[model samples]
Target: MATASHPHEHRTDGLVVTSWFAPGRINLIGEHTDYNDGFVLPFALAVGCTATVSQAAQDWSVRSAQEPEPVVVRRSGLAGADAVPEWTRYVLGALWLLTDRGIDVPPLEVTVDSDVPTGAGLSSSAALVCSVVRAVGDHLGLDLDDDAVFALTRDVENDAVGAPTGGMDQLVSLRGEAGHVLLCDMRSHDTRPVPLDLAGHGLSVLVADTRAPHKHSDGEYGARRRGCEEAARILGVPALRDVSGEGLADALGRLDDDELRRYVRHVVTEDERVLAVARLLDEGRLPDIGQALTASHRSMRDDFRITVPEVDTAVDALLSAGALGARMTGGGFGGCVIGLLPEGDVEAAGDAVRRAFADAGFGEPSLFTASAEAGARRV
Candidate 1:
């Protein structure tokens, strides 16, 4: 982890503005499996959230250029799911979770800006959540470990913010290394650092934002997690990780509901894909990993029901344009699709995707190549 001078070391006009950059993440595989206690391989992207924070004299205050009114919450009186807007919940939730963990910190004021497109499935929320949490930790002089920091961020999203999310986003955001992917074990919180050597293949990763935003508060994401939990309960396991692909099949055979069977299949298959990708990376077999990426996308689309038509179209367009693999990256409903392609072909592939979307009458999308960047740090 990178460290910086304390926020108090630099003050201006009676306020100390500490800026932190929290990288957005892309799931290389294992979609919708993190909440299931299954594996997920997410790499931090160069694109991310940047937050400027200063201590507040009165209460915890937040003001975003993206919003109209400043949100206020007391240090002892943090905002909950009901009182906070969705956009502000990331910061509020982080504070609540950190406080619950006994990190008694004072109130703060935060402002955020980001290149990571919201609702693009590139983990804009995670970036924002991690940034605020890190900034607050620094301001409070808390010397928490990376795991503790990640836990605080996860709790904010899953509990205080009322989003049924997994630990992958927060974990990667806090622990990611430049030029590497974090192969995270959601079940044990263990991470394996895998080298991301895309340059050797002359490949670049293009993230195309569909401009369709997904809000986890809507319950679609939560419902899927509930379904996985139900499957785990029926299988007599702690989580879906305890059930293998064949084991899931055997468990589903006892169930009469087709929907339940499909959900189990996705979880089991996704877990297998994640492990496969990790193994391939370990062996330096980068090209073979693309197959797992494509398969994971298909599973998320067909079984998880998270990918929307626009996302599907984007992936298809990129694949047709010679992308080695393409998939929707985030919580799914509407977001960005990431494509792995030869660096020389990136522009052409992006142009082809744009034309395809225009033909379909969808809004023009934003495209950019992301580096495998470092995680959260004071700037």
Candidate 2:
């Protein structure tokens, strides 16, 4: 663990600075499966968030380009814990969770710079939270394991920030590996590493940010989670993981409401797709995984109702441009679409997506090629 030095260690014109990085994450497979205690395959993206921290000499102060008032917070005093605003809650919650876990770390000044687009479903919040946690953990020398770190970060988001998020983001940020897609079992907290060698197949992953913001505070996200839990309760299972895709037909027969039926279909089918993708990757068949990705987008769009027009259009554009497969990534309802394209088609695929968004009157989307990157650690 690395710790920030005393004020004398660095020159501060009222700002103490210790820089840290947290990579964004993309789910290669496993859409909406985390809450189901099912499997997910994710890899860290090249784009991520970076933060600079320094002792405030009074408390914790956060300043960002989008914020006013510097978003000041006291290290020892937290006012309006429940009503804390979105952006600030991530930083504050990290400190609170760390402290509650017996990590004696001092907080001061903080500033953030990020390439991970906020609300683009690139795990920007998780990147920010993980960076804060890593910075504080390094400073305190707590030597907390990755699991412990993820637990604290997840708690901060779910309990403190009041976002009913699953643990995929935190886990990926903490344990990701370069050039490897992590097959994560959320229930058992186990990870099986698979090499992401798509380049050899002449394919690249193109991410198109729809610029649509996903506000986790919305009840829709929570409602979906409740649906999953309710379905599990009705089935006498701990989670949807206990229900196989083959058994989903019977499960749907049991559900009277159309909404619950749709939700169950998404979870069950998505879980199966995740396993299928994992197998394809294991067998060194990258191209075949495209079908799984495309199927995931359809389920998310129609069944889960998490996809918006921007996301759908992005996927449509990519597929129209010779992409093997495309789907909306992240928590949906906006964010980014990922396309698997042949190496020669990357530029054309990106151009098609941009053209589609423009034709749809949406803002020009950001496009990038992402590779699996290492998770959180000191530079």
Candidate 3:
């Protein structure tokens, strides 16, 4: 655990009519495996999106300090994804889906506040959508389970936002817990908690946001996802998750497309790394997962081609500064790198990354330690 936790405001304006929290998440090992029904290990961060809902006499309003304009969408206007401001779409989408499913939603003044860095591949969008869904669950007396909420928010991201992402973000954001990473099997949707004892072992999870804006909504993200799907189709497997190490070589040889081959290799190998991390934790070998972390970064850089120079530089600096292991997290291209470091070396590791970013001509990166915290909840 981080001794100096991120500065989080649990309360806004002294009090709120009704409030809910949905946290941003960090992927411990799993990368782009979710869509292929592969596995991922991720945990929730203490810093996340906080949504406050105040009852109004009759109109639905949505506002965010992070966004430029407030969106006022009535129930009838929910069908128009393009009608609202870009930032407000996540919340509006959630309401639209829930109401369509027969949840009686009343008018609300919704304000979203978050510490999670946008475009950092930290699942800020999921946090935003889940926060609204959670707040509505509390208000409307609706029985909202994690599975239902996952579907609701995912549809918003998929159809509404047209982002070709999997359920890893939404599932982890809603179901995470303190001192544990959720091991999610995408195929079965089977999830279990993996123990994270960073504080007890004199370690911390450091997230170094490069401030290089990236979004999965971009066309590149969708293109990579399609490439992975094509690889699976060529291999005669249902999905990439079904391709084992034994079959991976044969599968790769069958693909004439060089890009598809790399995509297959990354997802297959990355899924193994995720499972390996789980095993190491199970055996109480906390330090051993570092190599897996570095390996994941290498594959993302070489195979997935999602990582950018900014991310690579940050990871290299953290490792040189004594991080046990480090890699770029999120959807890649440009985002944040997470490092597992000795508690005592946290500040120095951050300093090295800063110097590295400056030397590389990238903007100043944000460095902070995040502890695993309880998932989405009323607070």
Which digits, one per residue and each the tens of the lDDT, describe model 1 over residues 1-379?
Answer: 1223653335778566677889888877778888888888889988888777777787778888677898887665344557767788887777776666666657678888777777777788889999888877776667778878888888878877777788889899888998888888898999988987899868888888888789766789888888888877877889888888767668888667777778888889889988888888788887777777888789889888899878899999999999888888888899888888889989999999899899999999888888788889888
Q: Per-residue lDDT of 85-145 in model 3, one digit per residue for the tens?
A: 7777787777777667666667877889988888888889989988887776665556667
Decreasing lDDT order of the candidates = 3, 2, 1
Whole-model lDDT for model 2 versus the true structure? 0.83
Against the true structure, candidate 2 reaches a TM-score of 0.92
Model 1 lDDT at residue 279: 88
lDDT of 2 at 285: 91
Among all windows of ten consecutive residues in candidate 2, which has the lowest summed lDDT?
A: 1-10
The TM-score, computed over Cα atoms with residue i paired to residue i, of candidate 1 is 0.93
Q: Compose the digit string of candidate 2's lDDT tens values, residues 199-317.
A: 78878999998888887768888889999899889988899888897798999999888988899899989889998888888999999999999999999989999999999999999
Error of 1 at 261 (Å): 0.6
Clashing residue pairs in candidate 3 (N, C-alpha, C atoms within 3 angstroms): 1-199, 306-333
List the global CA lDDT of all models.
0.82, 0.83, 0.85
Lowest lDDT sum, 10 consecutive residues, model 1, at: 1-10
TM-score of each: 0.93, 0.92, 0.93
